[model samples]
Target: LREERIDTVVNFAAESHNSLAVVDPTRFFRTNVLGTQTLLEASRAAGVTRFHHVSTCEVYGDLALDTDEVFTEESPYRPRTPYNASKAGADHAVRAYFETFGLPITITNCSNNYGPYQFPEKVLPLFTTNALDDEPLPMYASTQNKREWLHVLDHCSAIDLVLRKGVEGETYNVGSGIEATIEEIADLVLELTEKPQSLKTIVPDRPGHDRRYLLDATKIRDELAWEPSHGWRDGLAETVAWYTANRGWWEPLKKRAPVSEETAWR
Candidate 1:
């Protein structure tokens, strides 16, 4: 940063797969926790004017599926999985830098993102690619694990808002205020691809799986005037189409890092 004279830094790096974190947690901590500390130190040394850290809503842990309550900026950290715990540690470190060294920093906790070029290991890409190849779409047990779906473009916009207009030393929750079950999303993909629903196969759930996640994004919306322009179904349709047309982009990635049915729970 000193050599380049860059005034801003936005951290989007992380070992961000929940199931993979369970199998290999050491890497997650090293990358998400220690890596963040290193970046904070570098930023402080460089005297960057703005240091924005992108975080996941999983840092708040899971909400009860039966409740309408949503996670807010004030939500206490209750991370369950190794991935969530590592991210929580990073979030704390970011805030600590602001308080201790007076670094200009802001954070945004975003919901699940799906769109073009998503890694094939994630749920949407996994299912979409499997359907395209006439393979089975493995569904975790209960098939009801829920998440707030945010388009990647919208997530980018929210991060931009936080970097430009957000208050210093504050955390913002960025979401679409939309939630859906895994089963629902799978069905939608099947419909959009004109594939039979029988391709979905039920499998055992991962240990320490969070049941649901929804964010209260009122702070970003009301204060930063940020809102998601994409509807759930429309965004999903476009995402599926992108995957359908751009197999060359994702096919190579899927080949490089294949996610098997037994381990693609994230």
Candidate 2:
């Protein structure tokens, strides 16, 4: 930081997979928890002006699928999975630095992000890529799991807004205020790729899986004047189209981590 005269640090590093975290929580802890602390210390020592931490709404845990509930900035932390627990720990650490050492830090807990260049391991990419190749779209259990989706570009815009106009030591929830089920995403992917719905395959659910995650992003909208410009339907179609047009980008990635039944939980 000193050599480069860096004034800001944005932490986006994480081993962010639910099943992977369940298999080995230590990796998530080391990267998400301890790594965040290390960065916080370095930022404080280096006199960084702004330290922004990008987090996940999973830290607020899941809401009942039948309810109209949504997670907000004031929601209590109730992380169910190892990945989310590690993130919750990191969120606490970011706040601690601000309260204890007076570091100028702001945090944004965002919803699921989908767009071009996303690793094929994630839900949107996995389904889109699989449908493109005429491979089975693995639907975990009943495929009833729901999540709020945000475009990656919109997520970046929210983070940019938080960094520029947000108050230090404050945490914001950034989302599209739109939630969709896993099955719905699969159907959309199949439609976009012109693939048959018969390619959908049922797989066992991950242990300790949360049923739904919906974020109430009123704070960011009212405070920072931030809103997602991309509608979910159009954004998802564009994403699937991008994957279709650029097989070179995701083909090698799929080869590196070939989709399998065991690694199918998204």
Candidate with best TM-score: 1
The deviation in Å at residue 73 for candidate 1 is: 0.5
* Model 2 Cα shift for residue 29 (angstroms): 0.6
Residue ranges of candidate 2 with Cα displaced over 4 Å: 258-266
Candidate 2 lDDT over 23-72, as tens digits, reads 77899999999999999998988999999999999998889989999888
Q: Model 1 clash tally?
A: 0
**What TM-score, to 2 decimals, does candidate 1 have?**
0.97
Superposed on all Cα atoms, the candidates' RMSDs to the truth, in angstroms, are 1.6, 1.7
lDDT of each: 0.92, 0.91
Kindly give the stretch of ten consecutive residues in candidate 2 with the minimal lDDT sum: 257-266
Candidate number achieving the greatest lDDT relative to the actual structure: 1
lDDT of 1 at 202: 94
Candidate 1 pairs with clashing backbones:
none
Worst 10 residues of 1 by lDDT: 257-266
